[model samples]
Target: MKLFLIGYRGTGKTMIAKILATAWNCEWADSDGEIERRSGKSIAQIFSQDGEASFRKLEIEVVRDLATGPHKVVSLGGGAVMGTENRTTIAAQGLTCWLQATPATIAQRLEQDSATKSQRPDLTPLGGLEEIQTVLDQRFSVYQSCADFEFDTEGKSPNQVADEILVTVAKEQKMNS
Candidate 1:
């Protein structure tokens, strides 16, 4: 079955997805990277030139395409779960795992990932930690609603998170069976 990772930008979804993909020996897709490759532009470029609505349109298309496929692991854009259609698609297509982290941790992680700053656009008038806080506050409930389960990335390595994900998925399967 497909496994989808849903979470905020700095929540280690991408890193953990890579680990899970290797361990499971399955293909993995990153929604933002797919959009950038398909559109021949970075995500920030998409947001700056075409606007967030347009970028989100592209995101929806990518998400839908990936969701319907046999991909082993999929990491979605931070805002991907905000749309009802996207949430519905994920819920039906795979096990949705939320990789969560506090705003403070997110801010620190973002600060370290300089390349990501250029690729991801800002969503708030308030920049820095304030921006992360504001966006997380608005999106927390939406993330919670879409996720079948959560894994906090705070104080955890990507490998550790990947291990936890495997355990959780196995547990979920056992419960369902």
Candidate 2:
């Protein structure tokens, strides 16, 4: 089964997906990493050189390729599902789960993770909590509208999120089985 993990910039989607994939014996696909690999540049460099529109086109291609492929857990970029076509493609073929975090929480996490921020094209623009809040306020409705399940993860760790996903996956498996 394919599951699409979506959330804001600093949410633990990647870490959780990696752990959950290991725990569940599933293949893991990180959309941003894939996009960077396919594009041959860091996302920050991509945004600097090619801009958001170009990066998003690459994001769309990565998402489409991933969402249509074999069953795997895919951690999507923050803006991946902004496009209706991307949302429709994911929703049509897989379950989309939203990992929710407050803008404060995201800023806190981002500030602590300089290495991650160095590679993240989207996070570099934000100065701090206020900037993050503004962006979150702008995009949150879209994130909510696209998700099939929403899980609040403000104070949670990677293991906690993975546990929650594992439980949900088990329940879904049982129901479907």
Candidate 3:
């Protein structure tokens, strides 16, 4: 089955997904990267030029495509779960892990990652931690609704998170079997 990483922008979904893919010997697909590849434009460009609505439409299409594909480690864009269809697809298609962190952690992480800042468009005009909290408040319920498991990414390295996911999955499988 597909293993999906769902979380806010700075929650290390991409990093953890890569680690999981490598450790599991499977392909890894990132929703944002795939959107960029398909559109021939960066996500920020898409948002600035075409608008968030258009970008979200594209996100739904990408999620649908990936949801129907074979097993792999998939990292979804931060806002992909905003769409009901996308959330449904994820819930039906994969084992989802919600990588969570505090608003302060998210703000700090984003501040540290210049490349990520360049690629993403601001969702709101609020500053720093306030913006993070605003976005989290809007999406936290959706993330929880679709996730089969939750992984805390705060103060954890990508390798550490990956190891935890592996152990958790093993335990789940052991229980289910």
Candidate 4:
């Protein structure tokens, strides 16, 4: 099964995916990066030029394509789960781990990540902490509903988070067996 990392941006989905894939000896893919590769544009460019609806369309296709393969870790775009089809595909094909944090933590992380400013577009006019809070409020329940496992990344290193997820996955496998 694929292991999908789902959560808001700056929650370390991409970084954790890399760690998990290395630990599990599997390949990994980032849906946003894949979308960029396919479109020949960054996510910010996609949102600015083609609009969110268009980007969501590409996200759906990328998620579907990523799901059809051997076991792998997949880091999904933050809003990828907003689409019913994307949620359904992820639920049916993979186990989802939601990495969560406070809006303040997210804001700090996003601020530190140079790529975030360049590659990601703002979802609301009220950028920074306010926007993080607003978007998290809207997405909180949806993220909760879809998560098979949830990890608070507020105080942990990426390796710690990955180790915890690996432990959870191992326990789950044991229980199933």
Candidate 5:
């Protein structure tokens, strides 16, 4: 099954997906990257030029296409789980691991990431920590509902988080077997 990483931006989903894919010797795809590749535009550009509805349309298509393919790791965009159709599709397609972090931590990480400002768009008029907290509060329950597994990314490196995911997934597999 596909291993889908779902979480807020800057929660290390993309990094952990890379680590997990490397450990599993499988391919990995970043939904945001795929969206950008298909549209020939950055996420920020998509949001600003085409609008969020347009971006969501692309996101849904990308998620569905990725779900039907080989067993790979996918790092989904933060708000990808907000749509009912997206949540249902994800649930039916693969295992979802929620990579979580406090709003402060996410804000800090986003600030540190050089590409974030250029690639991603601000979801609210309140930018920085305030925006992060507001969005996280809105998405908390949705993320919880969609997650098959959850990991707090605070005080941990990407590899460390990936290690925890590997252990949990192995136990889950063993139990299922």
Candidate 6:
């Protein structure tokens, strides 16, 4: 079964996806990294040059390309779900795990990640708990709507979260079988 992990930024989707992929012995890919690799540009650069609309178009194409392959664990970029076609394709093609996290948890994680260093476009201007909450609020409904399973990783390690996902996937496989 294909496992697609989706959630807001800093929700541990990529790390947890890696752990889950290892457990499942499946390949893993980060949607953002795939986009960057395909376009020869970072996400920030894509946003600056082609704009979010164009970036989403490329993202949807990536999703289409990836969706055709075998069962694998995929980590999606935060805004990937905003595209109507991506959401529909994911809903039709895979089991989506929503790593539901409170904005505070998400904010702290983002701040602590060395690479991000608080460079998220939305948070750059009003960098604080409130801004993060606002952004999550805007995106929450769509993520929740698309998820087949939800895991709240408020204070858990990636290993623990992966275990939960593994167990859930095992049970789901059994049920489907």
Q: For residue 53, what is the lDDT in candidate 6?
A: 85
Cα error of candidate 2 at position 31, Å: 0.9
- Give TM per candidate: 0.97, 0.92, 0.96, 0.99, 0.98, 0.93
Global CA lDDT computed for model 6: 0.85
Model 2 lDDT at residue 27: 90
The local distance difference test score of each candidate is: 0.91, 0.85, 0.91, 0.95, 0.94, 0.85
lDDT by residue for model 2 (1-177), tens: 789899887898898889878996889999999999998998988988999899888888888898876778999988888888788889888888899888888878988997666787554455688778877777889998888788888778889888888888788889889
lDDT of 5 by residue, 47-108 (tens): 99999999999999999998887889999999999988889998998899999999889989
lDDT, residue 174, model 2:
96
- Flag the better candidate by TM-score, 1 or 3: 1
Candidate 5: residue 153 Cα off by (Å): 0.7
Give the winner by lDDT: 4
- Runs of candidate 3 with Cα error greater than 4 angstroms are none
Deviation (Å) of 119 in candidate 6: 6.6
Better of 1 and 3 by lDDT: 3
- Quote the lDDT for 22 in model 3: 92
Query: Where does the lowest 10-residue lDDT sum fall in candidate 4?
Result: 168-177
RMSD of model 6 against the true structure: 1.6
Model 3's TM-score against the true structure: 0.96
- Tell me model 2's lDDT, rounded to 2 decimals: 0.85
